[model samples]
Target: MTGRPPKRQRIEPRFHDGESGSLDMRLTAEDRPAAGQRPNAPRKAKPANRQNASSGSRSGPARRKSAKSRRGKGGRKRRGGNSRLLRFVKRGAYWSAVLGIWGIVVVAGVLGYYAAHLPPTSEWAVPKRPPNIRIVSASGHLIANRGDTGGEAVRLEQLPHYLPEAVMAIEDRRFRSHFGIDPIGLARAVFVNASSGRLVQGGSTLTQQLAKNLFLEPDRTFSRKMQEVVLSLWLEQKFSKDEILEMYLNRVYLGAGAYGVDAAARRYFGKSARLVTLNEAAILAGLLKAPSRYAPTNNPKLSEERAQTVLLAMHDAGYIDDDQVKVALAETATIVANRQTSSENYVADWVMELLPGYVGSIDTDVIVDTTIDLDLQHAAERSLRTALASEGGKLAVSQGAVVTLDGSGAVKALIGGANYARSQYNRAIHARRQPGSAFKPFVYLAAVEQGLTPETIRVDEPVRIGNWAPQNYTRKYRGPVTLTEALSLSLNTVAARLAQEVGPARVIDTAQRLGISSPLQKNASIALGTSEVTPLEIAAAFVPFSNGGYGVVPHVIRSIRTMKGKLLYSRKGDGPGRVIDPYSLGAMNRMMAETLSTGTGRAAELEGRPAAGKTGTSQDFRDGWFIGYTGQLTTAVWIGNDDNSPTKRATGGSLPARIWKDVMVAGHDGLPVSALPGIYEAPVQVAEPAGSGLVPPGRIGDDPGRPILPEPGKGRGPLNLLQRIFGG
Candidate 1:
């Protein structure tokens, strides 16, 4: 049957272990029988290597962790092993790993770091930017002292060579050579803080100190420390040694509201940063730790003591010779209080209020070229100080506000109040009070625009409106008068009657067009200055007349620059809306000019300069304003109580006008004349009285010229005022 192959091997499945099987093809070397004898027989399994086998699983024993390889094997590093900044922050995780592996890393990586460090950093080539600075007259009530904002910053290398030596001796000795990140200093700080349980001291490096002063918070947290360290290194790589040092020197706080060494020098010695003496530098340096506590103004004894300490430190550190230290310690100002402030800061606070929205921040080293000339500001401050001093510098309720704008509407000077620091209310720009007769020019201009000439006549008789009878400041009225005389004399009755004749709506419109941003009443009583307005608005509204009717839009920021010296903003020189006819404006200008020459604002007339302006005295003597312009400058002055209480005999021509005059004298001392543009003298023509064969009463309809009628009740106040003026 086998021979025929047909009788078929009975198909049988067998287990390989104990029975002949079809699946097992292998036979052990010695266990295999000859082919003929092993045919149809199962092969024996080979012996296993028991030494390397696991208990049951097919995988080998865990031999991946070879003793030699496992020593430093995983490649993960310790906390601060190889990071760029530090391990305290998660961002430094990668850098920390790199530093830890440095010992065994490829030569390539080590070479890379060294190569990155090797290139000489490019010089800090940031261009300087002209700072957008604002000038303001200090207010009588708010300013602690009246002084103008000016002067240039000081450079570090130019600091009396002894200056750096003194600073190093007093602050930190090893500031020059160390890299920005000082590990030893951090360790010392850590040790001290750990022992005290409270952070009592920090041995921060100069770079760290700079970091704190420039960008970081004042806290001493681990994360902050890491950021400071990394940022300081970055700064070191970015700025030149001298440039960084200079920035730090000029920006650091020196207390007493004196920000930098330059400000301190001026505050202490009435000198520029470049002209400070060795003792002055020592005194300024001593102000670093706690400027207010040791300022010479509040405590000269303490300030002198601190200065002596700094001098001794400098001498011991070899910053100054023994002889120089002795001289520095012995130096003293003849009169410290006299050195407190050269001028009052009445207008300076005004500028501060108007400046921020235009420039944003005052922390940078921006060079602001203000419209104010410091010499002029000083002159104005001097005059006010002398006048007020006679009354103990607290004339009446004791506060004043002043404003000066160039023909271009650039504020040349400002004084918001008498004591800027003690009383912080900025009366010049922020206070809104009745302008009284001062609001007449705008109403008269409206009349001129509405088909009436300056020669037009109106009865200056007393009139009642809804139980409200506004009397003249003198409680008397001129019978029939030209519009010019009414404004020049600031007659309340005539102004009210004129407001009625011109349509109060038009008066409000005229005020708005001239730069009055406050909400105006619709009632005609506005003609008598019944509505409230700010001194800033009064000053700005009059600017068009100064510019010869070629209106100038009031703007503070001429231009803005970034910290890195990029231009961010620049004024477009847009002019104010041309409201009045050229002839009408010129006629009004002549009368206002006369107001200074012979009328109420006679105080405003300078000895050598041709001046023109008006005086406004509100009810209860609560607000007083004198606004005018000269050949070179135009200024506005306001005197009032900060609490809005009535002043004792305060009037536009009294203290306020004098401040304007003083500011002008100082502000325009040497400036060339800038002739008013668009001026044209009106032809003299006799105005026909009303009710002739000419126009009769009410003949002129109450027509608001070309108004884009606002929805009912929108600015209803201005609209209502217009109705009252129309005798509604």
Candidate 2:
């Protein structure tokens, strides 16, 4: 083509109407632009005819359609993008609604599950509080309270204003404002507990606490919490604010077996709720958090600290001014020493044991009038504690018990242990231990009933029975001694010999008849006090020796009645009947009397009055006992180790005799000196003034009707001696 090629000519096409009435145009090569060159503009041409113009309009429609297609394509892209976003938003909304419904269902299901375990709303009601047992001494002084509700319910108005105020201030500040639930407090507690990873605070209101104590078991669980919330709401709706507070104060448990604020006040302060002071009220309020932990009797210093916290709370709540808080802080509550650790609780415990038998199923508040003389109880406890404090460590003795009874078998004083707080085991009424030679009285009484006189001779020598040989305490033999002398010296062999002479069965019968209810083994060892017996029974058994041989059943509760004065049980005046004959009673008294006068029990001898008793030392000095009595009272003292370990040679004549003498001295204070029953002999000398009505010492007899000794061969001794001395 480059070798001298001919040049190409340009051609322009013109529009024309074809036979089909369509417009058309044509262009020659001349209209096309050369490579890399701009094309020349086409010149406008006029329509050839009207038909041609109309045909030209068809081309305009084709161009417009092409432009419309381009615009539609862009709009389609925009529409597609918008539709995708709309679809995404719609899908999200649908799923959100589904999840919301499921969440509501789950919460409702959880709530329903917990609600199903609760009782029906119609059946829900506040449970009745358990009845209380109030025990008072013979003088009508409250000794203790025994029951689920330790004391009777106290009205809100009956208590001091500060008492309830302090409780609300520390326990629930918004108790009167909230509807049983403090959402603010609960949220704060939750946040704190979660942040600290431990539970250090509680969000329960006073009504909630009452609900838990009244109806719910002490369990920690989500279910229990839910139930508590439900019950709290119910309680709030049913009871007034004052009523709820009163019920909470009365139903909440305090320490030391106290149930209500009244009981706690009486238990720790020895006063009623109405008499509690501001300091005392603060202390009581403090115990609501942890009763045992902050009990004044348990930890006084810690309790005071807790009370200080309560006082501050009270001040902040505007219940008390700064001066009042200062006064409260300065004047700490004085906890009554006796109420917390008194020996009266021992008597109260005994009364409680006998309560159910007197009135079965205690369903109401009852008052028990017990025979415990507060004075004598104080004396007994004082003497026992004094003795133990002085000689407990020296003698290696750790515990002791005492029991005292009047001629009519009324328990005047009873000390179960050295410290009742340390041990509640009532040794006086429950513990059974060998009485050693104390049992010899039963053996001698049996002998006397079989015609053996106090002057009767019995050789004190080593004796054996069925491979068992009994030796005297002194391990020496007295060739011949009277029955009185043998018993006064507490000769073990002689007692064994007598048991053999008069069958052991007879001795047991005599013991049982005299109020020794414990079982006795039918063997020779029984005569030497090998059998175990409680101090109560032993003291009761000796009552006849001082009261004309009339048997007695040891009783502490004299009468029981409801709080409204409805009598439930009243002790009758009838005696336990005669258990020993005149001759036997006289003979036994004569022998036992010599023990206090010049024998092992000499330490227990009274100064201005005649006393009779026996001394007993168990094997290896494991137990030391002195059971003695005067014309006024009979008391038993036992000192030993709780572990049954031997002492440092402590004998009945030492600690036991001294404690018995001290107790007797206090018991017989201000009373006229009198002779023992069946003993018409006067005292050696009149220790008091002549106008004191004291029988002069060395007098032959006071009563002119004293019986005279009968002939040696008489059928039985004269009954006049006993009849005159005992007023039989």
Candidate 3:
């Protein structure tokens, strides 16, 4: 085929110009010349002329110059314009990389510096929590968790899944996947904050929050943040994700005097965390941002609103469904009432006071088994609060206290004040005030011991001794009344005359035998409760009359045990053995019982049970006290001002007796109604002799400022030293 084509060799030509010559073009590899031969090639010879040569040699440079000129007019302008933009982009990239590197370096430097300041990793340890005093009532119900933490550490699995889930959803959603820190979250936070021009969210994870709460100081500085990061990494390395979450849940502060979720749950809802509902979990989880502000006890509306936000977040995190969110949103969290919440706190504090004696120094956690009856405690608190609320302003009673004790001297219930949160000073045990007429029992007991029967007649008329002349509270004295009537009427003059007859020493001895732990004055006025005494002392002193004249020592904590179930202390025996004389006890009980049945403390009479008590109004009504008892319990109530200001004639029969009656009624609910332990004497209403007109003795002294005895006693008054030795 090639030889045949070669024979024809037909040519195709093309013309460039109108006048022109033809030019041959190679169309394929077959038209190219052979390698060794010059065949099939055409060349033009050079012309020999200086001007033409110069023009020909200059053509390339001239064309290039012409193209450069054209480029300067258009292409160069385009290229230069693009060059600035490229240079800008390149410079931006360079500086961005440089700044990024510097930023990393600075952050690394900060982290290193803060980490250097931290304690050695080998020495790092979770410090032991402060000693927690777990106080429980007589029925073994948790009265109050007292200490810095206010609760015990709970395990991770012990809490409900919704609890930690709520925490993670609202606090740190990526808690599972993130390695201590989440850069994506941080970047998003920065972006959102920058775009909104406000910090809407924090970049810290739950681990970081836990780290700050557990290990680091709460300071919002770069150093603090860096330390938090380092601690968070340490925590991640030391513990699992669940362990971290558990620590956080157990240690995080939840306000309302609650240090952990357990305490908070109990404080707000009166339930354990395991029993907390989803709504409660959300509310508790919402407290992490601001515990006080979101506390349900503080503001339920705000707490519920924050909880709604938390529920929405949980739904968005896919932890809860729409129905659940809706249900949670609709649910309302009811905080525990303040009175009920802190009722046990007073008992807990009372128990704590006795904890040191039982367990010595509280180096380890101890459980104090207190004698507080929570129900009775609540009753006492409610009674006191209700009494104060209804009559406090009218009576000028700014504060009040109630103490209820069983016959065995066990403090069944105690309320220190109207509100424990407002005042912690336990007036029931610590407040010492004069017990006006309430102290007359000792005087009557002394008189009965000295052979003065309840029918012993005493003239109530005034008698002056040296400088003092005591007047009746009513300013009108009943003439020639029996000892029983004089005491029932709380006649000051009769009480003074009896004190003088028995001698103040015997009266002091009688009070000490019964359980007055306070100092009693040896002066004649001692018969009128001129000495300061605590409500607890008064209540305890009345116990002997209820318990057939057996003395009692008031004790709250019954036993104490360590967290490991080792018994630290236990009360072995009963109170000081039989301090009161049986005869005197019977006579005193009979006389004092008459006071409640038909006297100043008549308002304290129970509907079904016979009661015995005394009404005491301190000088100028500074304090109103009702120390009363039934067969089962003896309670004392004090109503007064913390500032020692006089009340609006508040007598023991008004507020104090009412409170005592309420408490005793509630305390004796199930117990059988029994008569008070004593001898009962029938009322002896004597007919006044028509011709016997009782006249008061003449005033002897220029100044009648001192109180006097109506008749002389057989022996001298008991020494104050001996009274002190035998009494309290």
Error of 2 at 209 (Å): 2.6
Alpha carbon deviation, residue 716, candidate 2 (Å)? 8.7
- Candidate 3 TM-score over all chains jointly: 0.77
> Candidate 3's error at 577, in angstroms?
0.4
Residue-level lDDT tens digits of model 3 in 1-728: 44544466554556323322233222322343545658757533334432354545433334347546644577657778999999999999999999999999998888889999998899988766567787888888888787887776677888888899999998899999998998999999999999999989899998898888878788788888989999888899998998888878878888867887887888788777788999999999999889999888777889888999999999999999989888888877777775344766777777777776666787767788888888888888889999899999988889998998988899998888888777888888899999998898888876765545565678989877558798888899778987778888799999988888768887887788778878887899887788999989889988888886678889897889888899988887888766554444555666777788888888888887878889998889999989988778899999999999999999988899889898988898888978876454222222222432211112111112211111123212333212221222
Please give the lDDT score at residue 687 for candidate 1: 39
Ranking by lDDT: 2, 3, 1
lDDT of 2 at 558: 84
lDDT of 2: 0.82
TM-score of each: 0.62, 0.74, 0.77
User: Cα deviation of 94 in candidate 1 (Å)?
Assistant: 39
Runs in model 2 deviating more than 4 A are 1-116, 182-203, 217-222, 254-257, 290-309, 312-318, 321-323, 337-341, 393-396, 461-469, 573-575, 681-728
Candidate 1 lDDT over 440-534, as tens digits, reads 88887776555454445678888876777888767788888766677777777777766777688878877887778888898877986768887
- Give the range where candidate 2 is weakest over 10 consecutive residues by summed lDDT: 695-704
lDDT of 2 by residue, 475-576 (tens): 899989878889999988888988998889988988988899888899888987889999999999999888877889888888888888999999987455
Per-residue lDDT of 50 in model 2: 28
